[model samples]
Target: MSHSTLKASVIISIYQDVEALHAILYALSRQIEQRFEVIIAEDCECKAVREYLAQHTFPFAINHLTQEDKGFRKTKAVNRAVAAAKTEYLMFLDGDCLPHSQYVAEHLNQRENNRVCTGRRVHLGPTMSRWFRKKPSLIKLIENRLVYTLLGLPLVFDHTKNYEIGFRSTTLHKRQAKKYLTIVGCNWSVSRADMLKINGYNEDLPGVGGEDDDLGWRFNGKGIHEKSVKFVIPVYHLHHVERRADVSTNLQIIKQNTAQKRYYCKNGVDKYLSETHEKLKSNA
Candidate 1:
C-alpha cells in the first residue's frame, strides 16, 4: 500500500472487537496532531471487523491486516504490522485503549534516534467500561478527567487503577533518564530503523504477557534502551477480561533469551519483510 508523507504510524493490535476499534479510531481522528496513519493488526480475520472497517472512514489513512485465527500469536500479528508500516516512527496501541488527545504529539516531540519511548495507562474498571461501551465519548472523558479520576479513586468504578498516570501536563511531560524502562505494549513508540536492527518482536514468544519486557531486554542489548515518559503521555484502557492461557510460555522464552543474552531472535519481523521493505532498510 502506497502511503502519503506521514510523521508516524499507529499500529493497533486487535482481535474481534470492532465496536471498541470504532471508538479507538474516533479518538485517533481527534488527536491534537494529525500527521499519522493507522494500521489495524488483527490476529484473526473476522468478517464482522472487515465489514465495519469497509463502512467507516477517518481523517487519516487506515490499513488493516489479518492472519488466520490459530491462537494467541500477537507477536506474529504485530511484527507483520511493523513490517508493513510506512513511516520510520510508530506506536503500538491495543484496540481497547484510547489515546489522549496529545498522545501522538508528545510522542513525536520526545522521540530519540536510538531509544524507544514507553509510558503507562489508566486501567478502567467495570462501571466506567459499561458507561463507555454505551457511549464512548473519549473527549468527554479527557475534558472532565478530574471528575472521573475522583470517581475511580473511591472505587465507584470497581478497580480502575493508575489515576496518577491519567493527568497530562507539559510540566510533567519530561522523559525520565532511566536506563532500563520496563514496557507495556499498549503505550510505546520506537523507530522502524532501530527496531529492525534488533528484529521486531520475538515471534518465538508463544503468548501475550511478557513480549514488552522481552523487547525491552533485546533493545538494551542492541544499544537502543528505553526512556520513560510515564507522567507525560496518557492512554485510557477500557475494561476487558484477563487472558493468561499461554502466558507461561512467554515468561519461559523471556527467561531463556535473557540467560543466553539473545539480542536478535531467530524468528521475528525479518521473515515478513518484503523485497520493497528490504530496499527501504538498505536505503536507510
Candidate 2:
C-alpha cells in the first residue's frame, strides 16, 4: 500500500518468543482496522521466527526485520523498524502483547498532530497464558475477556494484573491530561514525522524501563503531547519471565539527557539517515 493509504505501520519488537509472536500476529489479524502492515522487529534473527513466518498465513502484509543477537538492544531493533516504516503513522507492540480487535482502529482514529497516543495492557496470568499457548486466539480472548480475567484473579498462578483495562467500556476510557500521560512502548502510536523529530527511541539507553520514557519526555521537550488511550486501545499482555537489564547505567544516562532536554537523541534513527545517504551516494 502507498504511504497515504496505509493507516499505520504496526512495529512489533520481539526476540525468540515464537509462540508469543504468533499470538500477536493472530491478534493483529483480527483488528477491526486492517489497512496497516506488520513489521516484526526482532532483536535477534532467530530461525524459529523465520520458519514460523514462512509457514503462517496472515491477513495484513508482514515484514520481518532482525538484528544480530546482541544483549538487550530492543531500542535499536525498534529504531530500525521505524526507519523502514511504509506509513506516516506508527504503532508499536511488544511480541507478548495482543491488541484488542478495536486497538488499531482506535489508535488510528485517535491520531493527532503533535500528540502521541499511549495505551495500557491487561496482564494475562499463567492460566490464560497457557490457554493461549495451547491455542492463541485473539477473538476468543476478546469474547471471554471479562470472565477469563475475572477467574484468573482468584488464583495466584493466574496472576492477571490491571485487567480492568482489558474491559472495553466507553465509560472507563479516562484519558489523562494530554500533556502528562506516560508512554508505554508496547502500545503506543505516533506520527512517523513526530517520532523522527526526536530521532526515535534512544538507542544509547541500552535497556528497558527508560527508553520509552525518554522518548515521551523528549517528545514533551519538542512540544509534542502524550495522549492516553488507555482503555480505548487495550492490549492483552501474555505472561513471560522478565528480563532484567542494568538499570543504573541506563538511568544515569536518562537523567543527564533529560536534564539537558536532549529531545533529538544522539544514538537513534539519525544513524540510518547517514547510512542511507552513503548508500545512495555510492550507487550514484
Candidate 3:
C-alpha cells in the first residue's frame, strides 16, 4: 500500500497503570508518521484510564475498548481490540512501554503480507522510570541512556542480548531465524488479515504469558513468518513488579498448542466479531 493509504491500529494492552499509559500515549503522539490509530485494549474497566481518555485530545484517532475486570485477561482484551480495529495492519503495545518517535514508521516500512514484525525494548530501571514519569521525553530518554552508560548502571546499560540500531541489524536478524525464539508481545505487528487467518491470540492460555509465543507458532504453522525489527523499532519498557503466578500453566498450554500445530484459536476474535455483527443487525 502507498504511504497515504497505509494505516495501522496500535492496540495497547493495559490493566490499571494510568501514569505509564499516559506516558506511552505521549510518546505515541510524537511519532514521526501519524498514519495510525490508538486502541487501548484494557483488561479491566479503570476509572482513571477512562477519565484520562475523556480528558485528552490526541493527534490521531483514539479509542478505548475495555473488558470487565477479570484475572489477567490480556488475551481477551487484545482480541476485542482486534475485532474493533478498522485498519489493514495492527501493532501491539503494552501500556508500560514507550515507543521511539519513528516506531510506527519503521513498523509500517517493514510490514509484509504474511509476516509479523517483532521488536524488543530497553527495560528502564526503577530510578530511570521514576525520572521518566516526572519528565517524559524521548530526547531525555536518549540522554539518560548516555548517562547510564557513563555511570555503568548495568540495569540500564546492559546490552547483553539487546539489539542496537544499525543498518545491518535487520539484515542479520532475518538470516538467523532460530535466534527469534521469544516474541515480546509489547512490540509486535502483523497484518490484520493474517492475524484473522491464524485466529489472533489464544484465550485458552490464561494470565500474562506464552500467548504471544502460541500466536507466533501458529503463524509459522500457517506458513506466515516473523521479521525481526528489533533495533529499528525501539521501545522503552517501564519497570514494574514481575508476575509469575500462572507462568507454568501458560507454558504448558503453549507447548500443547505447538505440538498440535494449531493454526486457529477456538476462543478468540471470532466471538467479538459475531457479537459486533449481531449488534449491527439489531440496530439496522
On TM-score, the leading prediction is 2
- The residue pairs that clash in candidate 3, if any, are none
Candidate 2 TM-score to native: 0.91
- Candidate 1, residues 1-284, lDDT tens digits: the string is 24666899999999999878887888888798998989899999999999998898788988799999999888888898888888889898988898888889989998998889988898888777667766777446554657655665454437877876777755565545453458788899999998998889998877768888889889999999788888788888888888867778889979988999999988989878884477777999
Instruction: Give per-model CA RMSD.
Output: 3.3, 2.6, 3.5
Candidate with better lDDT, 1 vs 3: 1
Compare candidates 1 and 2 on TM-score and give the better one. 2
Leading candidate by lDDT: 1
lDDT of 1 at 104: 92
Error of 3 at 14 (Å): 0.4
Q: Could you arrange the candidates by TM-score from highest to lowest?
A: 2, 1, 3
Residue range with the least summed lDDT across 10 consecutive positions in model 2: 148-157
Q: Local error of candidate 3 at 30, Å?
A: 0.7
Q: Candidate 2 — which residues are off by over 4 angstroms?
A: 1-4, 138-157, 175-179, 274-284
In order, how many clashes per candidate? 0, 0, 0
For all candidates in order, the CA lDDT equals: 0.83, 0.82, 0.79
TM-score comparison, 1 vs 3, better candidate = 1
Give the Å error, residue 176, model 1: 6.0
Off by over 4 Å in 3: 1-6, 138-178, 279-284
